[model samples]
Target: MKLIGVLLFSACVVIATAVQQKDSELTAYKESFSPLNYLNRYKDAAAVRQYMGLVETGKMLSRDDIFSLFNPCHRQQMIALFETLYGATDFDTFFKTAVWARDRTNPRQFLYAFSVAILHREDCRGIKLPPQYEITPHVFLTTDVVRRAYQAKMTRTPTVIPMKFTGSVNNPEQRVAYFGEDIGLNSHHAHWHMDFPFWWKQDYGAVKDRKGELFFYMHHQAVARFDAERLSNDLPVVQPLEWDSPIVEGFAPGASYENGQEFPMRPDNMQFADLPFLTVQDMKLYEGRIRDAVSSGFVRTADGRLVSLNSTYGINCLGEVVESSTHSVNPVYYGQLHNDGHVLLSKVTDPKQRYGVPPGVMEHFETATRDPAFFRLHKHVDNLFKLHKDLLPPYDLSELEFPGVRVEAVKVLGTCKASTPNQLITYFDESHIDLGNAVDTSTYKEMVDIKAVVSRLNHEPFKYVITVNSKRSANAIVRIYLGPKYNWFGQKVSLDVSRWGFIELDRFPVKHTVITRNSDQSTVTIPEPKSYPEMMSEVQRAMRGEVEFTYDSHYRHCGLPHRLLLPKGKPEGMDFKLYVVITDFDKDVVSSDVTVDELNHISSLGYCGVLDGKIPDGRPMGFPFDRRIPNEEQFFTPNMKVLDLVIKNVRQKPME
Candidate 1:
């Protein structure tokens, strides 16, 4: 027994030593060649010479081989090839190998792909990421913004400057750009695509649990939020993009590439042209087919079989077909309407590429929201989804109600000095992002302090105190949602129209024993940013043996940034409705062995379902609000309560 114990101790020491050595090597590599600097540099290179040489040998490269190529332009082709070659392999082995290979590559494409793989890795849940690769910065400011900041510093130019307005300042449509152009919001949209990619694991089993349903819900929620922001700005709701109609609300992104090339700005009243890949007639045909499927209650599959669209799975199947993911039942007949629409609109200015004009901002996820046309395009997509949803039956009372549970009362408590009960406050705050780490300080000492000032919406932290009356001590899941009470004309919107507009604030299971929740404690919101100073202090404390190294298990790579918790409201305050619902946890809970840490790691659950586990809730993604209320006037009953809330926009005073 003593000999075996000694051997076990020796094995443990060896494993610990190996882990320490690996960490040391990673730190050394980061210090020698920062990934951020490499991403900035290689994105401009025309080709990766090393990778091209490997390709010339005529030896087939493995999926891992594709990750070693250091060229941003070749990423899409490489990813496509990777899926084709290794789709049937074990996902865990494929992911770890890709991550290992990513460390050796110096391109932004490899890093982006690796980062996404890490986030989606089912086995790597709750694993702590290195501070440099932490996703907070990426969530707060997108990859494009980071690249632009690094470029600005390298070129000795100002990071941000006010651009002259192309359209009349008084035009109400101009407000969409302000919210749409926000870096954080756009970053969230881009990350959602990465989280639930349309083309991942084509031959492999489904990577995510409900990719098609998430595709429908995430975009639907985005359009709803966009409408909320539009109404807050006193602008009319966004109109769907009709292919034949002229796009009058032209957008100038005021964006530049790392190479200092500026993106083309669409002129006022610019008309879309037929693209080489997709034409107006093709779009009309696709739309017609999808509408026919919705109206006729069936769609033709790839193998020429009619599939019903009436069941719950039917909508999901239809979503996959319309979004045209690789998992689509039939891509040939259904076609990729949503994605193709974005592609066609992106090339509206240079459909044939005759003038050497690159695709517009709509072409890339990172720059899509920078264009106002994106909202119009998505509004059209949402309208199509709504058309299908309208055909579904409304939720019955049994589906909407919870047994023996009641939300007695609920109120929000704000942290600001003048904050009132049930009132949330949004204000503009400037954040200075340092680019010194990505730039060479030795060459230009003056550029070390170079920073980009970004003005964005911020809200004071608030807490939710809900009083629930339960007969038993069973667990209950609390769902909180917010939506604008008034429509574009300042008139109260019908419950039928407003049901789809509700934005999920948070969803968590609470022991009937514990009821109150602080906003800072929300699992949906992005974890608070850890400042450099605070991180250094923690490091010092650990070095002095005063405290052990710690990781915030609550902070997950997939979540909405906490900085954008609240939308920007009007100066006087915007009238909104906060709805709270308490449902029986037994019914809502899915049977899973996922640990508490793993559960917390699913920060994007409200928007993007859990990675590998069953979606936490038993009900549909958007439960009560997903379908129409049996009776619109009877939405607020004993189990659910709608409370009036106001979000006031506070302007910061200029420094003297």
Candidate 2:
């Protein structure tokens, strides 16, 4: 009996040691991911000297140069680093390996390196990352707002800073700044890029299926939605930037970098000029070749061969060429038009850098949409995709018709009973965001929970009640879109002009005859992201077997914010059309290799494709509207219906 008791005690001691070790590993991993903990490499003598040397040698990373994904040297280095970290046997090993590299490498680059490894490493699957907004608050918040938050933290007085409109009323374009400068929208854009990085290679894991196509579709949707918002503000649709003309709209982002450097401003009426490395002629040449390919219905391959553009894969191929990804048929011929265009606009104000100004907001996806010019630049990019789409034959009647489906009636009912039918009520809502993790409070005796309140456009919970008669019990895809009823001149927008402006509201699969979908559950939107401490606590609980671990809804952060799903409408109500289409799910479903866990994590498949899986929908992105609409009657089928709706901005007390 005495021997047995000693044995049991020894076994218990071993188990406890193992548990303590596991807990330590988990804590280390969580700490490494803290965005605020990013080491200041500029302050390190060795790091500063190395960076200076690279810049003087003209070898530093530049957005204007060929994208790093295609740069052989850069690609190899990144791939090797990612593979090393990903090959770790366990989470503890992975955490230790990352810490070793993170301490030795450039801090900014290590963040990217670490994130990429986490995404592809199967061991790291289902692990929740803290909301990036808290990691790099400067990217998502104004300079003044962030500085004020820091002051509040130091003074031990937490305050909620209101996000005021960035520009004055003198600039008519500023009217829609609320939409362009939205925190959630910008965060979505930033997270989307991280999820589907342009540098992602086949070696990382599975290739991003139709990535090039997604690039075009995502940006295309953003610009289209912006145009609709502009219409709501009584402003004209965005005008594409002319290569030779001067940009009249000046942008003052008022946002700073983590290192306290402000993003450069571009004064109004700045003229485009030739830089030492790039010229106007180069841009024209690239555009001319692309247009020529679209007009001729074929693209020139690298080996001097012609590939037909009249196939299912045409858009994907075009997207690769336009984005100038490594998959492009001929990089030399196509050039890096899309990437270079961003660089040009970002540096136009300081083309020669004589003023020592850094690149503008256009250089970063997170801050780009804050400027009105971003829409104009993207409008130009959309035009290129339109050129290809216009040349293709319109989607025929047979392609759109759902033989067994007929939409008899559709109505949108808001949560508020007093609201009129087929009308959405929009209002300003204030949200308090904790900024504690955004600053380094390690020096303080007590942790402070700084906060900020931002006012954003939100709509009352609404549901779409559609009455459809199905000949048989079969699954179907319901696609919803919203567009302004009239053009800039108050004239009813013709189908040809309005088709491009339609903003997809939601896309989901349904089987019932009477289909009802709540606005809060939109497939294209994501719930409010949890702060660092909140996510950390949940992760810790799951690790200790205190709660069930799941990544079903929180896995993908690259989604439109649920709050801004509806655009802010005029006070009196803005006329808009709610278009719904029920299509055969059989023709739309794509076979995916993802596991059941990953399969359940898809929330924003409409805008931000599934993580490491097929795009899910087999139809060409943008479906019926992707092609030209010859006539309204011909375009309408038994499965499609258009309902008249109004969006009214309900007045609410402004948060002081």
* Candidate whose lDDT is highest: 2
User: What does candidate 2's lDDT look like per residue over 144-175, in tens digits?
Assistant: 88888889888988688876767789889888
TM-scores of all predicted structures: 0.79, 0.86
Off by over 4 Å in 2: 1-80, 86-90, 539-549, 591-601, 653-656
lDDT tens digits, residue span 227-264, model 1: 87888788877788988888878776655432334556
Give the best candidate by TM-score: 2
* Clash pairs for candidate 1: none
**In candidate 2, residue 540 scores what lDDT?**
57
Every model's Cα RMSD, please?
8.2, 8.0
- Over 4 Å off in model 1, which ranges? 1-54, 57-76, 80-106, 121-171, 202-206, 437-447, 528-548, 551-555, 592-601, 653-656
The CA root-mean-square deviation of candidate 2, after full C-alpha superposition on the true structure, stands at 8.0
For model 1, give the 10-residue run with minimal summed lDDT. Answer: 12-21
In model 1, what lDDT does residue 383 have?
82
